[model samples]
Target: MVETTRRYVLAKRPEGKPDRDTFELEETGVSDPRHGEVLVRTLYLSVDPYMRGRMRDRESYAEPWDVGDPMQGGVVGEVVESEHERWSEGDRVVGNLYWSEYAVVDGDDLSRVDARAENVTLSSYLGVLGMPGRTAYFGTLEVAEPDPGETVVVSGAAGAVGSTVGQIAKLAGARVVGFAGSDEKVEFLEDDLGFDAGINYKTTDDYRAALDDAAPDGVDAYFDNVGGPITDAVFTRLNVDARVAICGQIALYNEEGVPTGPRKLPQLIATRAKVEGLLVRDFSPRFREATEQLHEWVANGDVEYRESVVEGFENAPDAFLGLFEGENIGKQVVKVAEPSE
Candidate 1:
């Protein structure tokens, strides 16, 4: 086993957007397990949009990060040493493991990965069976409330949450229209995932026209992941008493200046639409319920998912920055260390 542990620290808070310079890699001594804690070797680390907000000093749903501290996110790791009653060496667990090669976390903070799926990797607990998937399952079903035969429009439709939202919407008997950045992703939605329609937002200059063609009957529910001009366009086409679930705003994440687009506050009144922002962590109690359903769906072959993994702990910062470039098709994960299993 490696003696020295590698980690990524927040070098400086970004004035606007985060870049490679924002993170600094450092090596430190491997920590020993304290009483009631376990030492873990990280396998997979999640890179999510919510982490972007945590990086900022501003107030948000989660707390801000201190400069020079290692960044934090969900991770899957194997136990190397344990002083806790609930865990032992060789047990696999998932928890808030900071960007590091090894971690020492409280036994209560980690959960054992009990169920095994044939052909499915353990890192999936950080994606599909994890927070992002739960966000899609609950955020769309409970918040968006798409009824049968209704038309649902989703943005960031090829990402982990968006893709799961679209597929779940389809199974619930809704016509799904998705927006993706690449034709390959658009095709994946339409052909592979069985979406009713898909638009390559990058190729199309007019979002309104593309949505008009995809959802001719009007959008009954909009699951927004990437908010911007496209969200403005989506709001205009909402049917009477439509529902809008605001998941995330990836487009505005790296903004250094003012934002431009027709404000949709007036449209909410015009269409009698209810727009609500959703945070996955808020529904943590129902995570097991959502993941069970999603896992069953996956086992029964009712739903499918994809992952874009960047190899190595050192490359996490670049993989995180790549989210803005539309470099990932589904879940973007960073493989920090190999699985011992």
Candidate 2:
């Protein structure tokens, strides 16, 4: 009997924050693999802040999802059927795939997971052991370039990328300060993650004052995830020659037009900050090296991770929407299905 899958498609472009009406769920038959392709049964789905950019019908670093087409993100799955040399039945793989229960993907598009890390959970392939981990790995060490004793600040520091950035900065011996949304996240950063300080941006009345207290010596390295006023404030506190990694501007992702705020260029002029945007794919060649190191750190208990999992495939859209609301701490992922075998 032919199998079927439930999937979501883009029904309408959202004006601000996307609502449930923006996605249309459908049930369709799963397809057979042709040449050099594998049929995968998805086990986990990664929901990230960047996916918000894909929803808009505009030019972006990633391709925009066409209306009436299946949405896409990161997925970890078991390859149940393959007509490819690289994979066989029961092999677990990860790839940039569709928002569907089953996906037929080109063999080259999928990467085989290291079975040696058997102790790691499969959902981790969508979080810590996956893109978010790799993103934090490179963005912090390579781009931010924190030095021992230097002060480092991470905005959106309670989420997957931000949390990892803080831990990695700490490993480098930098004084890590994180900006999160809640008192609980602040506790997670300072208490559990060993950050020097954590500021609850939502509760704080003055950002510069908060920075003065948390990073008294000034910010030497910054991993910026949420832009807007938080960024505006950090710019004012940048130490000379401070390095900045532009990771995400999630704070403004949903705004309808060019929102105006404090001008940041003059601050850069006074501080001479080195700011550069980062994309994880740019370091794709070094992914293995970084992954190995991250795995080792995780195993040694030097680096820790957290996940706010939204169970079931039906809630994937909600999971994605939650990124904008500061609704999750650490990596947010969806549990799609369990391995059938």
Candidate 3:
């Protein structure tokens, strides 16, 4: 058995956007599992924008990573050794774990991978059937309740959560418009995801102008994944009684300090919009229910998803760094190793 593994640690917190220097890869001894814990080999690991917030030392929803301590994120792996009654060797499972080749995790902290379809990649459990999927599910259906025929706008529409939100809102009979960073992403939203319209925010000189043309009647619901000018533009066009769900703020995640932008408070008052922040952890108890629905939708072709998989465990930091650059079209993950099973 392998007695040691390589893992990434927080080498230094960043002054701005994180880069390779933010992490240090080092060899560490594999931990032995005590009672109710298991040792597993990581097969895949997720890279998400929200993780950038964890790198900060200030208050945030996710706990900060201590300098020089091992970094952790979502992963899917095969159990290699078990001291728990719930798992056996070779069982595939998923959990929020260390960014290493192997991890020693409490059995209660992990769950068996319930593949919703044949030939499904184990990595899908970290994407469509995982955190990002559930985030889109609840953030769209529950928080931004778009009624049939209403115009729903989603920013960051080419991303994992944003794409899912657009599709799900479409399923609810809403007309969906999306804003994406590139022309290719705009095409993906319009051609592949069935969004009613898509604007290339990177090229658009005026976001509000484009939004006005697309949503002539104004936005009735919004799922905002990118917060900055796009959100400010949407706020101006929100209809009375509009509902807005804040799923992410990738646009400002790397800003050294709070960024100054257009004031949007008065727009909310003018529109009487309900703006709510979506912290997926708040709905953890209902995760299974949400995942099941997302799985079924994915299985039956009612929903579509994309994944950008980086090839190796060594490139995990690169995959994460790419998130801030808008380099991924969907869920960004690193393929650490194939499951032994």
Candidate 4:
């Protein structure tokens, strides 16, 4: 029988930026599954930038977590006990299980995951096969539709969504330019990830000049993950009829207060560029179709993925903090609790 459980609780809401002190470790007894629920033992907990928005008490696409509550995020788990007919014991699933040893979830929230599907690991379904993957897929194809031989610029080029977006753009015959935080990340994209060009944003003092040197014809599509000045730079380089798919604004997440804006409204109007924010959840209706296509590409070796796994349940908080520092190479995950042998 399951006994005690440990969870990382939101100890204190961050005034400006979050630190280790924001989370507190707490233990409780494992909860029983009710009639339409199942008990899942957490395996891999996903750490993403979107969680930063949830930390704020402000309203957005999702609800904010109350102070002193368990911090929630995407998780892949194994069903240990089940009172639901849809999920039997030993079935693996992915859902919003939070930062806990175990969670009793309603059957509706959990989706069955096959570890060996198309030779893809279960952890991948939480990444390239899941939300981040979908964000790259639909956001690029639907939001930022590019013609063959056009130029595509992607910010946060080494992260999960950015990396995938670059590859997808390349597959569609676009010349891809990537903007990343480090020389190492730039090298990874250019040499390893097959990007046509990569600019180290941190080292480069003038981003607009860098873009000018890299893409002389200007950018046709911009897959933006880090907003702010990088996006501002892209705006000045947009080709006629260019599209900017806004995915995330991670650049401003750490700031305590909103900074004064030197508004880019004039640039937007001058370029006549279409800028649309994309949420992967909005494309959930076509998720299965996209997953199937992605799976085929992966199996044929046309698509690739990378992961940074942190071992142990207790290390979840640190794994999360690593995102802000760019400590992770790709998608970051915490191996919270292992599967039953």
| Predicted structure with the largest lDDT when compared to the true one | 3
Query: All models: lDDT?
Result: 0.89, 0.90, 0.91, 0.86
Residue 197 lDDT in model 1? 96
Provide the RMSD of all predictions against the true structure, rounded to 1 decimal.
1.4, 1.3, 1.1, 1.4
* Residue pairs in clash, model 3: none
Kindly list the per-residue Cα lDDT of model 2 for residues 1-341, writing each as its tens digit: 23898999999889999988989999998889999999998999988888778888898998898889899888989998999998999998999999999888998999877635534677777777789889999999899998899999999999998998999999999999999999999999999999999999999999999999998999999999999999999999999999999999998998989699988898888888999999999999999888888888887778888899999999998998888889999989999988765
What's model 3's TM-score? 0.98
Badly placed stretches (over 4 Å) of model 2 are 115-119
Q: List the residue pairs that clash in candidate 4.
A: none
Task: Give candidate 3 regions above 4 Å deviation.
Answer: 116-119
TM-score of each: 0.97, 0.97, 0.98, 0.96
Clashes of each: 0, 0, 0, 0
The stretch of ten residues in a row with the least summed lDDT in candidate 3 is 114-123
lDDT of 4 by residue, 65-144 (tens): 88898988889999999999999999989987768988888988999887675558878877887888888999889998
- Candidate ranking under lDDT, highest first, comes to 3, 2, 1, 4
How many residue-pair clashes does candidate 1 contain? Answer: 0
Q: Candidate 3 at residue 143, lDDT?
A: 96
- Pairs of residues at least 3 apart in sequence or in different chains that clash in candidate 1: none
- Compute the lDDT for candidate 3: 0.91
